[model samples]
Target: MDKIVLKNMAFYGYHGNLESEKSQGQRFFVDVEIKTDLTKPGQTDVLEDSINYVEVYDMVASIMTGESCNLLEHVGALIADSLYQHFQGIIGLSVAVRKPSVPIAGVLDYVEVVTTRGQI
Candidate 1:
């Protein structure tokens, strides 16, 4: 199967378990891999034959910017579920939600939660 990869898409969101996090908001980076047969799209070279990148980005942006979730898991799951519902061609997908600013008292890069759905 072929794949459509959207990596390190950034968005500002107020989602976290901490009240400070919710109030202050933070940057969330999402990586999505949509698995599907790209043979038709590759051969035809038509937009309709392939998944629309803009649409997918918008969907991800909406979820990231909308409503607050206590965990990155929920955010990832929401993105995966929404994409599956809107795009029937998606055989499977994996969503990785990254939180750059964690409240932990340690030095680290970031925290990420990944959610996968369907048969990849």
Candidate 2:
């Protein structure tokens, strides 16, 4: 299998358990990895023969910005599910949604939830 990975794609959204978070919003980061057979695209060197990454990016942006979720797990699942449903070539989909500004007591880089779907 081959991978098409989009890392640290950023967006601002309302995604948190706190009331202030929903109103104020914050920056969120997402990482998506799509697994599939890339042999054909590698050989053909044609855009149509491979997954269109721009479309994937746009989809991610839509998911991140369009809706509000309380948990990163739900956000991640939505992305993975959308990818699997919209793209036929994707055999496995993994998504990581990161809340960089989560209101934790101590210092931390970010809090994230990773979700994977499709055949094992």
Q: Number of the top candidate by TM-score?
A: 1
The candidate scoring highest on lDDT is: 1
In order, the Cα lDDT scores of the candidates are: 0.93, 0.88
TM-score of 1: 0.96
- Taking the candidates one at a time, how many backbone clashes does each contain? 0, 0
Question: What are the per-residue Cα lDDT tens digits for candidate 1 across 7-94?
Answer: 9999999999999989999999999999999999899999899888789999999999999999998899899999999986899999
Name the runs in model 1 displaced over 4 angstroms: none
RMSD (Cα, Å) for all candidates, in order, is: 0.8, 1.1
Off by over 4 Å in 2: none
